[model samples]
Target: MRELAKVQGCLDRARGGLGAVLVVSGEAGIGKSRLLREAARHASDSGFAVHVGAAEQMTQTRPFGPWLDALEITPSSRDEDLRSVAVLLRAAILASAGELGSATHVVIEDLVDLVERLAAEVPRMIVIEDLQWADDATVLTARAVARSAAHLRVLLVVSHRTGGLPAIGRRLRRELLDLDVATDLPLAELDHAAAQGLAEELAGDAMWPAVHPQVEAARGNPLLIELLVAAGGRSGEGDLRCALREHVRDRTWALGDDGIRTLQYAALLGQRFSPDLLAEVLGRPPVEVASALQRAIEQQLLISSGHDLAFRHDLIRDTLGEELPQAVRASMHATIGRTLARTGARSPEIARHAALGAPRGDREALELLRRAAVEYRRLAPAVTVDLLTRAESLADERLPDQVELELLWALAATGRTGSCIERAERRLQDQPQPATAAAVHACLGLIRQRTNDLDGARTEFDTAVALAAEAGQIPAAYLADAAST
Candidate 1:
């Protein structure tokens, strides 16, 4: 509101013929574009003329692109005489966009001259957005108009991300900061209280407490907060992934394959990572990893904090991870697991990578999975179940094995008796060897006993002992023991 009020004051002064420029700067998703809309609305309500324009990455080659867009300037006839062209600012820009695309000093003066005339007739506010993508001429025109603000009755508002700025664009930002008439508005990320207010506003009173937990996860960025809320359910997750993938891809288009691979590896490590660790994971020299990280920083995809690097937003990390192919993702995680284990990372972290990276039916992987389940079973039963389920899938051809038994026990402990019962029944129906069938029957009998169905429990227990005895070479005694009270 204070920034909006400052804009309100700028409009008031412009109406009184002492115009000023308002320069808004922030990181992407920090609400630069939204603030510009609020200021435009405020200007419109006060009876000031409002014109809005945007600079786009695709249109950077067109000099004065923002100005031409602001005025909707286009020549109706290319054959118009010099007399007609000189009298019309629209013709001047159309011509400048054609041959003088670099936008010389003469072109800058013409825009100042035109803005002065427009504001003289009616107090006008022109808003230019995405100034980081603006051509050199656009930056020059802003500086020139700001310099002539004492005479013109127009408030020029320009907004851009503070990072990834080209050299010429930096000049305009610096000069505006020095100018007395230019008000610098730098938007920082919202504090916790402010973020909660915004979240409550989005979710309403009913969801205030519900959204509290995710506010910190949003990292004080507004767009991420909204996305985190929108992405709550199973189906919304797919939609959110698609939306974020496209948005992040647009921002990361300039990044090379090495930079993208670095980001993916970084995502595997978590949001913030040590370069040396990342280097070990990638199997690259430390200097090569550093160069890739530096490129990511320059593109504003990552921010460097001392020796470690972090994604500028978690959404970037998520989208990049989502884009990796399943095979590729698993291979990378496999490498990550080995690397983390070599570096003496925690058992849980390595276990997670091992579970994610393991190939099918590998006994070593089964051992790792078993160890991980043991470590997590008492601490996090759900995590134990998920880890065992992954191991079970990998060992599909070797059903009724130790991993499957551990998964069944884990499920039963978590009160998923029905799921475990159903799984055992499906395995029995597959008609495996007699010993395997006995194991399945033993599992079912245990579930029946737990559920207090004594008659049903005996029926399953009798079948298990019979199946084990039918195999002849296997002992019925162990199966009987498994089915005992």
Candidate 2:
């Protein structure tokens, strides 16, 4: 609602002979398009001439597709200058052959000039939706139009997803960002109360307690919520996944095979992935990956996010993951993990994929999981638990005794002291090496501290210190200091 007010303000500014550009940006299905439609209706009611066009994924390869769809110049213009510019633009589009560079320049120039001339006659509003999918030439022409109409009575409105744009789309977004005369309107998902209200309205009298889970799962995405409501609130978790998959399929049906394959691989690499990483995973060239990404962006299946591509929605990624067969999914994950490991990616990222894809008792996966657990120990103790648990699952006689001790320590850090104590006591009963015994005592001490048993903690710490000192290990000093603290 506040965003609509902002667009209305931009429209009011345009009425005063000052042209403006308004960029409506958000993730897919978050209401950017709906906001533009509302702006168009308001412009029409205010006696402003409005023209609307949407960029299509299927047509993005065609040059100047969005511009050709949005503008219509009739020869009945009263102004001679307007008519001349319009004629030139039409001629350029209809041209059979010409110098490519020269013809493109002329088309861009005339299109901007034509819009300025028309605006001088009457206030005008132009709305282009899904600008992220617009062809490069169309985006360039739109930029030219925005610059030329800056001081005229024209309002330029464009909507795009916040990220996952091609290079040219990114350039257009940068140009808009630098515009002093433009307004940036970013939309966010509705809050729970607003989402509930919308769901109730959509569900009518069919609203039920069962609908709450669907709403929660939608996570404020209006389109997903609408779909759930349309299903008469019968959506369970599996139903929700299917619904999201169908939603993504409907949008991506026009993508070619290459684009679909690119998406499938990208999904495996997670919601955000780089072209280089995807290329490595698919064993394709970077150029091929870039082209496929471009097609996917044009189709609105992905958006450009900085140096990476992100799914238009997290649900889309989940949906894709759900659709993959178990074996294929595991294979892709294994390949991705190996690639990430080769590229020296972060331990946690590599471990996550490896844990899912690598065979049980895989030494490499086990080591990566343990290292990842250490990495997450302080930053996210719960994550440490998960990683260590995975490592424990893979651990065998091949794994060193210290790894099991490390897992118990990690579990203790997460306040699972009872489990840690039990595991440590059982291991200690086996008369392990001095260092191993010290580690067990240290782990139990930490758990005792967590449970407010200071005396017990001190006793364990003292025993740990004596064992480590007897082994001539520096860890005793650290354990002694830990108990003092």
Q: Count the backbone clashes (under 3 Å) in each candidate.
A: 0, 6
* Candidate maximizing TM-score: 1
What is the C-alpha lDDT profile of model 1 across 1-485, one tens digit per residue?
78888888788888788988899988778899899898888888888888888899778877777876786555553423322324454454666555664335766777777778778888889988888889877888888888888667888899988676677877788988787778889888899888877777876665556566767767788877776556543244576677677767777765677678788999888888899999999888999888777657756678977878888877788788889889899888878877887898765677678778878876666666677776776677677788777777777476445556656656766779889888777766777788767767776777888899989988987887788788773545555444332
The collision pairs in model 2 are 163-303, 163-304, 164-303, 164-304, 164-305, 165-304
RMSD of 2: 8.4
| Residue-by-residue lDDT tens digits, candidate 2, 1-485 | 68878988888989888788998888678898788878889998997898888888677766666665666444566657556655665576567453245677777777787787778878998988888778777788878988876688889988887664668878887898688778988888889999998888887775656576667766787987887776655645666666777888866676666677678879989879898999988888999889777767765577778999888667778777777888888878888888888889987889999888877777878878888877776678688778877777766653467677766766676678678788889889888889878878887887787789999998998888888887889775556534442
RMSD (Å) per prediction: 8.4, 8.4
Off by over 4 Å in 1: 77-103, 205-212, 231-238, 254-258, 279-301, 313-315, 338-355, 361-485
Model 1 clashing-pair count: 0
> Residue 94 of candidate 2: its Cα lDDT?
67
Error of 2 at 110 (Å): 2.9
